[model samples]
Target: MDFVHRKLEPPDLQDCAPQGTKVTDTDPRMIYHGEMIPVGTPDVAQGLKDARRALRTNRFRPTGRRKSMIIDGCAGKTTLLLQIGRAYQGLLETERRPDSEWTPVVYINVPPRRESNLDWSLPFADFFGMDHTINIDKRTYRSTDMTEPVAHAMRESRTSLILIDGIDRIHDSELTTAFDYFDCLQDRLRVSVIYCGRGAIDIVNEGLHNRRRSDRPGASEQFRSSLPVMWIRPIPFQKGQEEGWRTVLQSYDDNLRLYNHQPGALLELDEELHERTRGYMDTLDQLICQTAQQAIEDETEAITKEALDDMRVGRNEPDDDWA
Candidate 1:
């Protein structure tokens, strides 16, 4: 027992033996968060090609315009959405659009922990090049008061895009209610809404559609026409999924070389290290970064199976069962 451990009133992993320390999980990085990714067709390159075509053809409206699209998927929806949003923002800045035409973007995570009712109008202020402050605290907002304001804002903007991630976490009842607001708002606005989630938004839209189909004329058909839903099928992690993975693995080819570099270099367990992480981009990233830190503390030459295994699947040494 050293003074560092003895003197500290509160104990942590510092008290544990070197071997007991854990830096990261080598567990399966096959987790699929709600990311915006190119919906690779059935996880194949050609599938992606076809999906892109569908997005351009079937999803596009006259004048090459399109209503908001919902990219629904259970895995990697947020990552995918951010990627697309990033690309779109870059293009918006780079390419030439009419000075008068404004298609601002809104990226939000509608989690179970988020404000139940959101004010969509307030969020897009910055995107549209407006200097308005709405919903200053993201963590504390409830969306209940947003429908009217959001609908009004959408109608005002010439063209707009809304990218909402993690909406599935919001309850069906709330979502349906929200759909009513968005639908009514969409009726007033020609906005193209994009929703990214773990699964499909059809059920949500269906409920919203059903609500109006009973008494309204062509209401259900109109609702379907208003917002079209699309799914971003899983793209197989080919050579680590994206092309960037190839560069990553190539740089870390010599597993032993990792030890020579900065401490916490993830050991190249296999020549196809990048290949192994394909389709699990987000998960593998987390695993590699975390394991690297642990390797440094352990003074290991390279990331070992023991370390990765500990991260992915627990070693579960021992713990006193509390009553």
Candidate 2:
């Protein structure tokens, strides 16, 4: 992902942005550094454009901002947030010098699996030297309450970019609690967030059970209007769209030798690979990365079509869904 993300350098290109319908390599804002089109399709380019613009303008908000995003190809939403935080942090460093005015872009990853009794609203407390001195008696400083710690962290670091990854992974029972935490932080903090992962279904509808009706019944517009939900597909190679995709994969092959021993070999099995992956970004990445390991184990220089066919057949055997 780092290799893919570095490409988003600056300049300013007309096309290729998530929204740009007609993209050219001209005046591109160095944004394409290391980053490959998750799914080399035209549909997602528009969403990418919107996301990039929002990030630049600090418009990714909750109630008024784009609250949700449906990212494709990548796994581990928390890790991706960390990466975005690092990128924004670097950008902040470049844009604002030490003496200049700028707040630290705090990256907070909340895993629903780790439901500690401690207050979750101000999770950054641990990151900003508040979680030290693990003492039952003196830990809860009146000044360092749930919200104060976050405010202090923001003031001390002087940042407005607050990234909170993983909103859908929480336990079913804690969904409302998590929303409360999210609502509190979003409403009180003066920062923007990149809420990654499967955004709530509400993101498409308006607010909560808020629904609407035109010719047909539909959810409220607030849900759809608030957060810009962009769905990223896996990089694909249509019947004739193989060259560009091959270039992208070969680059991957070159970087991960163990994975791409057959740098030029994937083209041969493109048919079968496409059939199984069906252009899903995450699954495709997993397939190729895994195949690279398989190649090393099988002592083969190239991934054979027979191997893929066998794997596909086995993958579809009875009870395959259980697997």
Candidate 3:
């Protein structure tokens, strides 16, 4: 017997909205929140796979700590990290130990502009479902006092992965100390670590260079030799990939038609949108949301070229009318 392949259908518009309400009547926030459909670009998929491999390879290292660095611009770094966290969490759930009570993967955002390394303990504690305030007695706790509880929690929980997002946000003065803290975490906890941020390659390289020249004894050498950096290349809108744009639009409104079924309607629309947005996933997301909301407000069944053109103009205008 022969079987024919079939393409997956778009999600129901109602599914993107709240229960018992039409998508058109649903608030924009509600719709936008549910629209986190990653396009699965090759670079993103490969970067995630490489990160997981790095985690597995670093799991058994003792003092030779290795980390996976995901370098990307501000455009889609957070989204990619969130998606990776979700994917890693799902994989961990599948292989969850029967006796383990803690989550296998812990994702924490690096605090922005905070110089103290102890501040990181808050997010780490929260990830393990512990009260960070309990560790803080009179706001005077040693770094070990704060990190020990986190280590104990991970030990009890059997967490295998640690994902630190926004490492680039660490202040210049605190950057070296932040790396040292993470090195200590891996050395003490013996868990896999992945750091995501923009322009981290230069910082890490400079730190390694400085460590090599200094007589200081630490894990800096281990980090320099073992850690593998994975750069997420930009998602370029290549030719013959118009279906990607269609998929994004259809996710918002399944009934959306680009140009009334014209011969090259989708192709034209895809080219224009890609050119305007420069193939940035974040920009694509914003444009889709903005265009979808405008269509709903205008009581139109489908977005038109005119509406897209107007949105593009408003986006470039200094008055901030695009938002």
TM-score top scorer: 3
Model 3: per-residue lDDT, tens digit, 141-164?
Answer: 443336788878887777767778
Best by lDDT: 3
Q: Lowest-scoring 10 consecutive residues by lDDT in candidate 2?
A: 27-36
Q: Which stretches of model 2 miss by more than 4 angstroms?
A: 1-48, 59-83, 96-103, 113-118, 132-145, 170-180, 199-223, 235-248, 258-262, 307-323
TM-score for each of the candidates: 0.52, 0.60, 0.71
Task: Report the C-alpha lDDT of model 1 over 1-323, residue by residue, as the tens digit.
Answer: 01111221211223423443333333111111111112222323332343344444532455533455555654555645655554444445465553444445556555443332344344444344453433646655333334454445545544445566666665544555566655655555544456666543554555456542233344323445345555544234345554444434333322222232443243344333333343354455455545555555565635655676556512121132323
Candidate 3 wrong stretches, greater than 4 Å = 1-36, 59-66, 97-100, 134-145, 208-226, 238-267, 312-323
- Best first by lDDT, ranked: 3, 2, 1
lDDT of model 3 at residue 301? 31
Supply the TM-score for candidate 1.
Answer: 0.52
Stretch of 10 with least lDDT, candidate 1 = 27-36
RMSD of each: 12.7, 11.5, 8.1
Q: How many residue pairs collide in each prediction? A: 34, 43, 0
